[model samples]
Target: MIDLPIDLLITNKNKDKTVDLILSFLSKENYPAIQKITDSLMYEASGRAFIKIQTGCNKFCSYCLIPYLRGRSQSVPVSQVVRQIKTAQKQSVKEVVLTGIDISQYQDGKAILTDLLKQVLTETSVERIRLGSVYPEVFTKDFLDLYSQNVVSNVKNGRLCRHFHISLQSACDQTLKRMNRHYTIKQFKKTVAQVKKAIPGVSITTDVIVGFPGETDQDFMESLQNIQEIGFSKIHVFPYSNRPGTLAGQKEKKWGEVFKKTKLARAKKLRDLSKQLEENFRKQFINQTLGVLIEAKNKQGEWVGWSDNYIKFQISNPNLKRNQIFKICLS
Candidate 1:
């Protein structure tokens, strides 16, 4: 069976001339090539807008194929990002998620991710700005300070989401080394501690990959211990999958593989731990007032929305409307 680019081609057929240019690459016949970066902006008329500030990645994590597929990191101009956010605000988008393959590596001339964020907050009228996953190592003191200020002041006005998702593939140093993760366990812990101290009541979330090649039982135990100690509000756990053409996959070809059952068992354990941590985090906010952006009505007719710190909640108020921000006490 052959897979064609029919859906993508059709979607962009009349909207973009670049579609024909891209289709030529998939055709069997040789055609003149034109080089250009794909559009980085994405939005809906009245909902959350996702703006891609950059594309590709420079971090070549051992198990990932993103670098190979997307090429080296490249960021959109800061002016363009600010303009896109303004457009989203004009379209009545209540929330905007600044996304990228590696947004922490974003740079346009002298501007960095911090500068881009500042520009958005200062210039755009978007009600809420959410960030995509970022590397813990990139959360420098200056960035943390900026975030602290924003969370304290902007959160009340619905300008920023007081939540951060950092990617921590493994908490065990040995496993992280094998994964080619640059930071050490100690460094990661320090970074997390600093962030927590700087931004009180902020929600910290992370991703953990279990069963990486060469991970031992001791390593898994250490990972579990570290995760419990960190007390992340949310954890995204994944069992390591061997992606061909990557460093880990190549190493697996040379060495033996870890048992699938062992990987599943470890992943399940971490997922259960994640649930406990999430519940604890949510409990802390009980009886506290939070700013929630009403999203939609559930099947039971209850209004559903997300708090500034990313907590999903439902209210029984029938008069509430979507796209409105309201302060509600968590019960």
Candidate 2:
């Protein structure tokens, strides 16, 4: 019922500094402006879409580009977002991820995240709905309670798999402070524990940066200890990529080269640990069947998919098509 032009932003080309000035203040919430641009582009391509409801972050994680690139926190109205979801459904998007620069930061005064979820799932026609990143601080009791139950409370082949990608950048409290990460290890641990206890069998993943401007050996050890304690299914480790306009960059410019080298080394170490973590996590899947959504066609005519819990699955049968739901028995 809403008229808007959804445009795709181009991220290619050879150092096109001329266009950089224009992109600095682009707001994703301006849907009519977006649709104007997308309406033209869709004439050539099929529409597989993204609904980014939350816009920006207030937690200025030192090594991140989200706050500056996306700006401060703004959430799309539930009515408007549901309208977009209905539109995407008409176009045959089998699943949709509710994304944002910082979805956790979205709170329209009394209208909170749980309210938005109730509105979306209850009213909309999205076949499958997935959430974007959620912050550690706001992983409240209400979120866990509503999302805990699978469609039929069927433990084995459950529905409505609500996963969380929590940000626990460094398990070490000291390193977290140096990186200007707001939450502490104890607080983060307690929050995570409570969430897991609330939502059993929920897939939890995280992000960790091994080396920062002021991380020490003891700090790295502490991080590893916490990672071991959490037993996270997966982790994306970035060796602290520094960007300008952040406080850390300003303070550590003189030690840039040295810091970068240390970061590289620490990154390698963390990566090794991450692989071990994955292998350990995989052991839990030794004899389990998972509901997977096939999303890719691999070489040799195989179909690949991701489980609702976010595990990768591969099948060699060419008969299966992309975006089809399948039950995968993992080894």
Candidate 3:
């Protein structure tokens, strides 16, 4: 086994200072060092790219280790983000996903995520802009107002996709409180309502965790009911897992654990509910015209792409190339 010298700076949240320390150490040891803080624009051969505008997380949820691992939030300058998007556009990239560890907390000087979005719309010629997962609490009225203006009614020319995947760990207030999620179920529903009102036909997707420690049957039922009522286009259900060094993990270690069979049963039930909800959402678009971005041909030689609402679609056209946008009626 090779032994390597490794130093961790968990206490130092400033990335710049961390880099400086590493460089100084390397220079003193007469070792060559190269550093690049800003990431270069990357274009996939399929004409898609992901632009990271921020990094780190400050939300210390009970079950999440992200805060400990990533430290506080730090945003990339809007100018840098716009520069990368423009470069990707020049390379013929049709879609770009604005990603971050916690995008809702993204801020560069006086500009927030909404401000950065406006600049991207005004400056870049990218066909579609997809946002990564965002926190529901950050969906303020001002943000929604901004979104209402730029969201393209016509998918062909729309720069922003009509899909939002907000993180909702649990719908039950008690369970959410235990997880330290920082928002109530009612607040989440209100945000969802606001989003749907601002952007008609917008698809909302979410993440749900079941069988968290101390969750009662009543809590699970509440979660299930709320999930069904929300009518998410897609639901990603995950069974709670104990992550080392997390608050939940420590608590589980101290207390008796829930039965594995029980957790599995809960997960399966939520997954079934998710499938039903997805089908229901899909049925709503039948015979309706939707815009799709042709990504690639599937194993059966049928062209496949995602709609603006993030629906997977199979087109009969064999002549279509990647990155081309086409309108089709869902049947």
lDDT tens readout by residue for model 2, 194-248: 9778776567788887667667777777888888798788888887766788777
Candidate 3 lowest-lDDT run of ten: 7-16
Could you report the Cα RMSD, in angstroms, for every candidate shown? 4.8, 7.0, 5.0
By TM-score, who's the top model here? 3
In terms of lDDT, model 3 sits at: 0.82
Candidate 3 lDDT by residue in tens digits, 26-104: 6675333333237645567667898888877988999988877767888889999999998888888888998887899
Candidate 3 stretches greater than 4 Å from native? 1-37, 40-42, 154-156, 253-256
TM-scores vs. true structure, each candidate = 0.87, 0.81, 0.88
The TM-score-based order of candidates, best leading, equals 3, 1, 2
Model 1 TM-score, all chains together:
0.87
Error of 2 at 253 (Å): 5.9
For model 1, give the RMSD to the true fold: 4.8
